[model samples]
Target: MNGFKKFLFRGNLVELAVAVVVGAAFSGLVTAFVNSFIGPLIALVGGKPDFSDLAFTVNGTKFPYGGFLTALISFLIMAVVIYFLVVLPVAKLLERLIKAEEATERPCPHCLSDIPIKATRCKFCTSDLATAPTP
Candidate 1:
């Protein structure tokens, strides 16, 4: 029970659960957007807003290819929205955060080569830096 509890409350498990919930919510919103707005735009071009209802009968069997098309469009729209909205912004934020830290890197005293602030010895020049103070 203790081990199960630990696993249940683990950081990754919680994060994944949250992610799944958010993703489901986002998917719903995207689906709504496509149905409400994009569907009309599609209707303007074609009589049908969604292809889900458009199907053909073959040998008295219905092939619902329209539903597949609708699902495909939904998936594509969701992917585009996630990439442009979430992924791009998050990546830019991470890049900015990393750039700030990278800008603070100190150079090696002996070789003038770039080194981390906490580095005690210069990797480029092999300088012994026993007395060197981190800035």
Candidate 2:
């Protein structure tokens, strides 16, 4: 039971929950913006751009093409906003942090092993080499 609890309530789970909440909030914001601003603007230009009404009946069923377009636009806007506002910055920040964590002082050219940056000779082989940046 303890192991199960630990597995279910890990850091990744918390992060996933946060991400879901943020995504929902962001999607809601984009949908509100599109409904309030873009929808009216498009309606003004195209003469009543309500997707719900811009459909046709075939046989007995109506195909809601305009609603589909509205949904598609909302999805696109949400994706673009999340990509630019969250994913890109977080990826770049993680990359920089990883690079900083992996950085070393230097390495010995003689033995091709890690050594102190200011060392005059390779600690393993005891060979003095020209002072230069480690490859």
Candidate 3:
């Protein structure tokens, strides 16, 4: 019982729950934005973009696929927004924090290995690079 309490209240579990709640809230915002703004724009193109109204009847049975369209579009927009707004910035920040050696360092002439700038010798191949970095 004690172990179960510890497991339930673990930092990762709590953080995950918080993230899920926040994500759901953000998704609501995205849905509202898409429905209020983008929906009209799509309606202009698709003729009544409220997919809920767009439907078909098969053997006197109505098949409402407009709702599916709305949901798919909303989901796609949410994915794009999250990717660009959250994932991209985080990735760029981490990249900046841990700079890649190859980006700033020069490639060795002999072995094509990455080495420090202004290095006179290629550490990987032990080749003289005094004449490297040709003008």
Candidate 4:
């Protein structure tokens, strides 16, 4: 029972669960907004937004291009929202974290080359320098 609780509530698992819930909620909002507002607006401009009934006779076959258009729009909206809301912020946050890590990993300024954090001298340049004490 304890093991199952731990497994379910681990830090990463908790975060993942929260993310899933938030994502679902966000998806619902986007879908609703598109259907109620954007769909009608687009339909007003372009005529009949729901294309499931749209058919074109090519030779003897009917091609449903309206459904394809709706699918394409939904895919585009999903891509834009995911990219702008999730991917961009996550990438920026990761970049900031990497920069913070790299700031500590860099070698001494005088040497202008990579050396251990505790190193007092630039190994390649052989220049003496003081290193800040590690707390």
Tell me, what's the RMSD of every candidate?
A: 5.1, 4.9, 4.9, 5.9
Candidate 1 displacement at residue 10 in angstroms? 2.1
lDDT of 4 by residue, 1-135 (tens): 999998987999989999999989988887886678767877899787766777799899988887887799777866776788779999999999986774444555775677776777777888876757343
lDDT of 1 by residue, 1-135 (tens): 999999999999999999999989987887787678777877898777678887899999999899999888777876776788779999999999987774556777778888877778888898977776556
For all predicted structures, in order, the TM-scores are 0.65, 0.56, 0.60, 0.53
- The number of the candidate with the highest TM-score is 1
- Minimum summed lDDT over a 10-residue window in model 3 is located at 97-106
lDDT of 3 by residue, 30-77 (tens): 778777877788789877765677799999999999899877877787
Candidates' lDDT values, in order? 0.81, 0.78, 0.81, 0.78
Error of 4 at 13 (Å): 1.7
lDDT of 3 at 77: 70
Candidate numbers sorted by TM-score from highest down: 1, 3, 2, 4
Q: What is the lDDT of candidate 1?
A: 0.81
Query: Which residue runs does candidate 3 get wrong by more than 4 Å?
Result: 44-47, 100-135
lDDT of 1 at 35: 74
Model 1 TM-score relative to the real fold: 0.65
Alpha carbon lDDT of residue 125, candidate 2?
93
**In model 4, what is the error at residue 32, expressed in angstroms?**
2.3
In model 1, which runs have C-alpha deviations exceeding 4 angstroms? Answer: 102-114, 117-135
